[model samples]
Target: MALKFKMNRKGWLAVFAGLLLFAACESDPVLTGDEVSYAGDIRPLIDQNCTFSGCHGAGSVQFELLTYNQVKLKAAAIRREVWELQNMPKDRTMSLEKREKFKDWVDAGAPNN
Candidate 1:
């Protein structure tokens, strides 16, 4: 004998949505021609834009980006929020050049160098 399983419409939709999200997250990052450096380019931008008091700084509720390790851990979120969504830096706006640099760094695997 064979067993059979059934799912409702909502269940099917939920499964499809989850698969789509998984695929999106798994896809490789798109790289730009120019190289983006973590220390020289990205870190400065984070310090100037992201790590202010009450934001991503020390003792804050939000994710702290004080060090390379911390920033590297949240690299994906940073790309999504700052590069794609353009919703980060809550109080201020980052220049287009800076945003592109951030994307490039994340796409390059958020290297420590």
Candidate 2:
């Protein structure tokens, strides 16, 4: 019985280690080469986090950021809000993972991948 328990524990540890390794090695898909500047990175992230979070969705916000062109139109403002003013992504639910993704996108020229 003790041997079985030890084997199970080792197996679990191995599995956990493998999962961590995989997660650590994985990278976010920010911007590909065949993409535009506005569509790939900014719009989708804003739509997912800002709009879908019930903070700025349909009938929720005065200005919706649900589309590429919509977000593209406010490129300077969005960059300003996030990078300069630090006033966007109004939810604490936005993990550093998401923030890093957004930053990487911005750094990658805010492309449309």
Candidate 3:
């Protein structure tokens, strides 16, 4: 004997809807703007902005950004302050281009390279 399964219209619709929801919830990995490098792109920016005397470099703040480990630890906060809130630096603002670079770096998992 063979077994068969049949679904009513409502059941089929429910399954279809669930599949759509599942697919919609799945997101592809984001490829940020040109590849950003910690040494080549991010470090210089951080040095210029947050690494001056009495700043993030000198351990003045609760955290620091002088090294890759420190910066990675604070990556989420950095993104929020620099990109989302735009209230960091406390003295000046980063340019649009620089902010975009930072955002890209953060999106790329804040890699040390």
Q: Which stretches in model 1 have alpha-carbon errors above 4 Å?
A: 1-33
Better of 2 and 3 by lDDT: 3
Model 3 residue runs over 4 Å out of place are 1-33
Model 3 TM-score (2 dp):
0.66
Of 1 and 2, the candidate ahead on lDDT is 1
Model 3: lDDT equals 0.84
The global C-alpha lDDT for each of the candidates, from Candidate 1 onward, is 0.88, 0.63, 0.84
lDDT of 1 by residue, 1-109 (tens): 9989999999999999999999998895665546788988999999999888989989779678999999999999999988899998786478878888989889878
Inter-residue clash pairs, candidate 2: 36-112, 40-112, 40-113
Best by lDDT: 1
Candidate 3, residues 2-113, lDDT tens digits: the string is 9999999999999999999888878765666568999999899888888877778775667677778889999989988888888777765678788878888899899888
Per-residue lDDT for 8 in model 2? 81
Q: For each candidate, what TM-score against the reference? A: 0.68, 0.46, 0.66
lDDT over C-alpha atoms for residue 14 of model 1: 100
Q: Tell me the lDDT of candidate 1.
A: 0.88
